[model samples]
Target chain A: MSGRSERVRGKLSYAEAIREALDIAMDRDERVVLMGEDIGVYGGAFQVTGDLFGKYGPERVIDTPISELGGAGVAIGAAMTGLRPVFEFQFSDFAALAMEQIVNQAAKLRYMLGGAVSVPVVMRFPAGSGTGAAAQHSQSIEAWLGHVPGLKVVQPSTPEDAKGLLLSAIEDPDPVMIFEHKLLYKTKGHVPRGHYETPIGEAALRRIGHSLTIVATSIMARKSLSAAEELARQGIHADVIDLRSIRPIDRETVLASVRKTGRLMCVYEGVKTLGIGAEISAMVAESDAFDFLEAPIVRLGGAECPIPYNPELEKSVVPQEPDILEAARNLVQGRI
Target chain B: MPVEVIMPKVDMDMASGKILAWHVSAGDEVSKGDPLFDIETDKAAMEVESPGDGILRFPVDEGAVVQIGRPVGWIYADGEVASDPPGGIPSSKDEFRQSVPGEATADGSRNNISSGPDNISGKFRASPLARSLARADGFEIATIVGTGPRGRIEAKDVRNYQARRESEADTSDALAVSESASGTGTPIILLHGFASDAKSWTRLESNLGQRPLVRMELPGHGRSQILKAVGFPDLAATVRQTFDGLNLDKAHLIGHSLGGALLLDLANARPDLVASLTLIAPAGLGPEINGELLAGILRATRSESLGPWLKKLVADESLVTESYVQAAMRDRMEQSTRAAQEAMADALFPDGVQAFDLRAALARVEVPTRILWGKQDRMIQWNHALRAPGRVAIHLLDGIGHMPQIEAPEEVARIIEANL
Candidate 1:
């Protein structure tokens, strides 16, 4: 006897993949919950949670008070108990308010408890700029949470990762912070139909090369991958490490590639100073991998300034694909 | 010359302050410290002061939101002739061009703040002050993890959270060790040799296969930079501290060489903490030790030279990887590590002879004790296995060296698992 053919292929937006994950999780486990502002009847600000309220009803798909702190606290409380809550922030910019609940409480509770209690919570933030939401609304803060301890921070650059990581995050015993790039919500990709769990804290080698290791996360990962493809045309082979999970970051994978290429350029959309690049640079410095580095670790991040409202100024603020290619060229040539 | 009057980061977390009302309009002369405008922040509303004595050339309207550290208006200092306004509205043009709300200003340049998500309404709602301050200083509010009431992105939350996050990231990145441990068995305590920590047992620990084990630095290794003259008493104190920190009442004790000796010391000092003892070619059993090997271990300068010395402890030379040797060398070079090693070598193996002959202590140890010895052990002679008390069990492996725990982990684990 053969198993029933159940594989269904369909084109779904990034937003839809996330919604489906929540839907599947809620369906399988009644303990799963959804909490965020305007995530109820309004179907969420971006409509990523469309009709979830109607399907799961009000208790599971809760519309929390207009307080990020309060909502995060409630989610954490529920997670500490038995339920798995997927808390959402209308925008990633709003994640700033819930830092204490996230960084101090949720991220640390497990380690502090000596792994006695498992915190299975998933906090979602809509990140990135490109829809011209201006300064306050259009920002990518994945790098911030990725720096915290106890918390597993993940950025799904593709629909498949979004679905897979979301499932993994919801099922995880520790707290997980998921950053969904705003521009990527509408972008479509192939998402397998099944309950799949993507390994957290592992870097995905998107495009393999031997010239330079481009360590990128979140939206910048896609940008770096594109830049690597473009650089490949000019004979500059750039290996791209898509850091799906930032905290407990896959240093082994990054170091392995850096050791082979002998060069590294960490590219992220966050500001340059203490961005992900700094962490990667310090990792290279502390490891035996440092001796293998032929070129100085290069960091290409957003300009050290607030994002601009003007289209031209906004474009200038962040490192685009071309900027990454230029940096990669310079790094491989020993220019910095 | 126009003296630009920029808004300041009034509150600790304020990124942008909205201009509730511009007190002085175009052509209005204002003195230093004079109320120029009423700015409102997420925290509270406050008035901005004029920087100098001059005509108040305001470019932005009364209700405009001005960013922190952005020139909102200009004060023409006495005797300094004002240049022609770039945008035409004389009094307002200087302020407008110089502090055109969102125009890049010099109050605090190069502030890169990460942005947040796209607005579903297609319109982002932020105070005017936040917008202008963000633009001028280049602050991305998105990168800041806010602690505001309701997740409202505030300026103070951004700065504080950023600093905290950066510090945390720096610490973790600097200390890069694989954190996750795999295993599903009772907790086992693995102690390291002299000048080494739990990391030395990383390979053996991985091979143990699903047993909750915690490998920690002995007194002066890894994070435990303890300083005390290395002796059985000092080693016992370090082991006690580790057990208290981990809240472990009883654990299966596994130690290699110096660590093995330390385990015996712990058992002799506080027999209650040890569930069972697995000593891999321990030091306290025999009076006979290789003086040349002990001296070589203490004086080896380069990792290359030390590699062969370390290989002598293990039956299998394959266990001595370049990275492993480098890690050992690095640990050996630490001030605390060096001190601990020298003190331990002197205390345990003074004059290249076992300092504490624990044959009597072995008789008193009620806990089931097992000792494994390598026949070809170069560090400590294998004949020590025969010196164990009548009650203690001893296993002698042919061709195995001093570090059987690392070289012959499978056999050692099988012996440990049987006891567990």
Candidate 2:
């Protein structure tokens, strides 16, 4: 949509846009603060919290203990006490250790207290695979927290959206889990200045087409756009919908595209079975979109096996741009 | 002219920077390397010095996060005047931005998803998907309007649109012609071909006694409301709407000429509606159609001129009765009716050639379909009956022309009743 292509205004990397959102939110609202291990002096694992720690100072920008539970517990406690704490997980894989605090405390405190308390906690997880972080480091665990009703799951594909959605997430009364793809940190695009919200549950139509529709999430959304362009050259147009928000999936937008093209392919970096694609497929199947389908719906997610340490093997586990293109061609050709 | 100041990428990993405080305010004269502002990166807070000697100006708020390579402000040289500011950070406005303290954050109010792609909030148009779903479910999308942007039919709109169909279609709409309230059998849906209407079935009506009949005016023909545009899909959809509105799950279809093609389209679109197919001189058999005969029938205001095209309907001149010529001439005299016929002819039979192909639809038909044609039919080529798929029962009569029901009603009736 009229996103990065509006004009040649300067470009900012995904990491930079996120930092800008944090700076704007914290500066405007005194209650908003930052917390995580190695965030203050060492920046962040991916260095997303740049200069934010230094500007807000030690109290507002906290560097916690190495223990995942201890760090996550402090952030959740801060959120309960009328504070908007944005906690960063050095690696999304580390979220497993802090699940108790995230799911049980930060997510439930507002409801458990019967509306008396509000946990306006925003947790940022440097998720996804690309840099061969191996099994322990690279994992797309958004579905884990997304399954819990109390948490809102969001993945911003563009630099502009990353800034806007993160701002909205911070303002949300409930806990918002922001899954930032580690490989996407260096990607750049035009970002709007100041503070503006992209809304939490809305989906963005990245590219329009008539042949087939692709519902993509996170880095896969970016990859799909490229795949769509390549497909366009071959006279095969592919529609792509960037599923910015996962839990509150925009069914109308997805179904609308599916109806137009009569074919749908879900591209995700998470595990194929019972992942976001499964949810989307089931949603369309149950909805009226099922009747419009000319071909069986396809989902190209990661392999069932754990991410390998080898570079080539790591690339093979999750779908790449080529993989998305192939799946789109297969779906349109009625081969699958 | 003043020079623009940009946020510098201080280190390899340094992504974003914030202005903690400005050492020099706007209009403050400064030399190169002079301290301009105190900036902080993720690693450290440092004072970034001015690069040129001029009046220092700020384009961004003190606390706004400025990305690397983005213009943060401008530096004006001595004796230079500026009128407008640079284009905003992806924003096309002269006003820099609201300050952090003044910035109003979103309350996280989730807007209605169906407000369309760009937050366009009123009126609902059925999205392609909602229409496909509606078609697949055998629901008319045009009748299923939702409260989306301009009544845009989102998926929920189609589902919710189904709830209103049963009661809404029951209202007094002049389009339907179901006389005997109770359907005694699979009601035979009679669709008259081009340049014709329900009066064309007068002879067949008496021949098939006690049989159920659902007479439908294919929109804008008789009492039905005129369709604004008569495309192939639109015409098919109109008949499907009337067919669905009747609440008839299955019906035996007896279509003549283009009406036969419409039934084929309906079967292809929604095969569940037709129990048996009976096509009399259908259009899709071949691409050829007699333009002169069609144009002459619609243009002729006198029974004398209309008698010629009427003669071609049967093998013998005796079938062209004075009453038939008068009835056909009477239809052409209505200004509105003639205009609708003209539009339908141009759309359905463009440039005197049959514009549509129902051959693909023939393969989709699962019902026991039969084709009846007179060997001497002149209006639509009788050879069109030759292209009918092998499974379709073909009966080529000897003496009859195009109007098989009128020239040979007993044989046509027997063929239709046999399929039942």
Candidate 3:
């Protein structure tokens, strides 16, 4: 029924898709460069870069010292001078150390310089919990960068989108931030061969239904899709929207779905307070879709606390598939 | 650059404002501080003044729920070419407007209710959508029992309430039919056309005095219950049951349009109950029908849109009075009644093609049958009367449209008397 399912060739893990994207970009353009801490020799903290360092050599794939602020600044400066730099954060939590470069410099350089110099830099963040990395290393801080206007933030749930969106992010003129959920790196799915760009700022409709709309971001989108499958078995169908991008949010897709389903539930792994769910909930409330809501809008996000070291506590910190199932069932059955 | 007209932040805590109405349309010259539009905030509805004098170009339609400080329109200065709003044109302009009628007024009521924690103030805990649906369908939300968390009223609750109310109305109507059947002689049962009720036969009924008369309201019309019949046979059976319930051995059946088609089916099914048949511009003769006119009537929500179609029912437009238009509008006000009529129209006449063939029903008639047609009838053409058998009587009235009863009541009454 969907053209996306028909276009697939073979299966690849989400981590492999990112590696292939970097390989294709480097071969296509000499201006493309990779910069990060332990990305060259150690083959990335999560092994996403893999043997790309050996394929591209050290000149193209350069590893930096343990200074995120300094490394990010250098990448942003190289982007202004025409080189396409793909920077990876060892963990998304360390993005806090480079906030001065990402938030102020990379986000506002072009607008501040009267649109003379464009930043074509792409940053990959290994975000989310369930790895027992504790609060310091395992955190989803994509929302912080997403709040900045000049930056384009994306979270690809599927391997196809991971490859397609990464390629597109490399091609984007503005500084793009790609938040790769650590849990989704090993998950495998059919990835379309060659260079394909899943346009950023557009939300993908994973499942179509009329009972309600479930808008989920990053890894939460995967969990929501599974929950939707269970809901369908119970005769409670929901439109599952995988919000691949968050910065230039897909307001139209979300609004259109909410209008059809007459209910909305935003599921994300970010902190519940001012996370992506809050923005989405507010966006619907302020749009015409508000009138179509049959039930109260729901938000099932990460608990308002740091990620714990214990595996059980870590799972409880963020929303799981069961959480999505219960919330969707309640919203659709009008229990909430 | 044109001065951008934004949805002003009226209240300190207001996140969005709904533009109730645009006082000035596009391309209108406006001065600074002139009333451009009225916006409804959470607290109150207030008129927002124009920021600069220019030609107002509303990129956004009225009733749009816009975020505070977002530009809803742009005021182009003299000799300055117009441009799109910075936010670009919204794909669906009127999507946010309330689908319900008579509730668009800015009466300080919440223009758009939110499911937020702050909006919960009434005795019930209904969802915003549930409240809107109930209000639109003319149901009091307080009366609806909630099935949501903490006894919150959900949209499904409102829908269940409507279904229960319709069934209750149906039961009372059945009682009224049996109780009202008190006449002595063979009764003249009159059935109305599609989208019409028993009240439509009032003009013809007054002329048939001293004769036992029974005005039967078809399902989905007047006070009758809505019947979701499978086919024409099922619809005919329903009318037949109503006749049988009256304890009448036989009835002189008179039907018009859709009603005529049903009576023909009834006579074909149970010839004993039908003493005689008077079909007036009835459906089922051919596939041809004025489906556009039928659709226009069903879609019309106000008198202005409905009056034109009602005027086509008669050759003389004067017969389609203001009261007639208002009466039809009032009938359509009930959501269930309108829905039932639409379902019937789609089943009987799909895409203007009559779904049934009653030529055999007319040919196999054992009893006396009369067909009335108007020369100026624009609904079902008069040519259909030519299909009638030689044994049947055919009367084609001059200067008349679909409705011979309203245009030439005396003539229609005389023809029915001849059949009797």
Using TM-score as the measure, the top candidate is 3
- What TM-score do all the candidates reach, one by one? 0.45, 0.47, 0.54
- Ranked by TM-score, top first: 3, 2, 1
lDDT of each: 0.73, 0.77, 0.81
Better of 1 and 2 by TM-score: 2
In the range A135-228, model 1's lDDT, one tens digit per residue, is 8988877778877768888888999999999999999988988888888899899998868988898889999988789999888889998898
Interface RMSD of each: 19.3, 20.5, 17.5
TM-score of chain A of each: 0.95, 0.96, 0.97
Please report how far candidate 3 places residue B140 from its true position, in Å.
5.6
- Cα lDDT tens digits, model 1, B136-203, are 55766444432222123333333434444553565421211122366664578777666556666756
Residue-level lDDT tens digits of model 3 in B1-420: 567676675643355788888889889999999988998988899999989998987457777886554457788888777664332353224212111111212232311222211112234556777888898998688777554543456776687577658756655324124222344667887888888877778788767655678777777777666664635766777777766667778888889998898888878777877899999999999999999999999988666788899999889999888877876777775544667778778888889889989999888877788889899998899999999889888999999999998888888998787667
The CAPRI class of candidate 3 is incorrect
List model 2 lDDT by residue over A1-336, tens digit each.
Answer: 377645446799999999999999988999999998899988898889988767888988888889889988888888888899999999999999998998888888878889998888899999988888899888888878878888999999999999999999999988899999998999999898888999988999999989899999999999999999988755468889999999788999999998788888888898776689879988998987776776556777777778899999999888898888887876664343
| TM-score of candidate 1 to 2 decimals | 0.45
Better of 1 and 3 by TM-score: 3
lDDT of 2 by residue, B1-420 (tens): 456676665643344678788888877888899988888888889888887889866456777675454457788778776554433232222212321111111332211121111111221244555767777888565455333332234555565345334424654322546454444777888888877777778788777767688777665565454555677778888777767777877888888888888887777677777788889999876789888888888776567778887787789879788876766665664544667778888888888888888888897788888999989888887888778778988999998888898888887888777778
Model 3 bad stretches (over 4 Å): A1-9, B1-124, B134-151, B157-420
- Candidate 1 lDDT (Cα, whole model)? 0.73
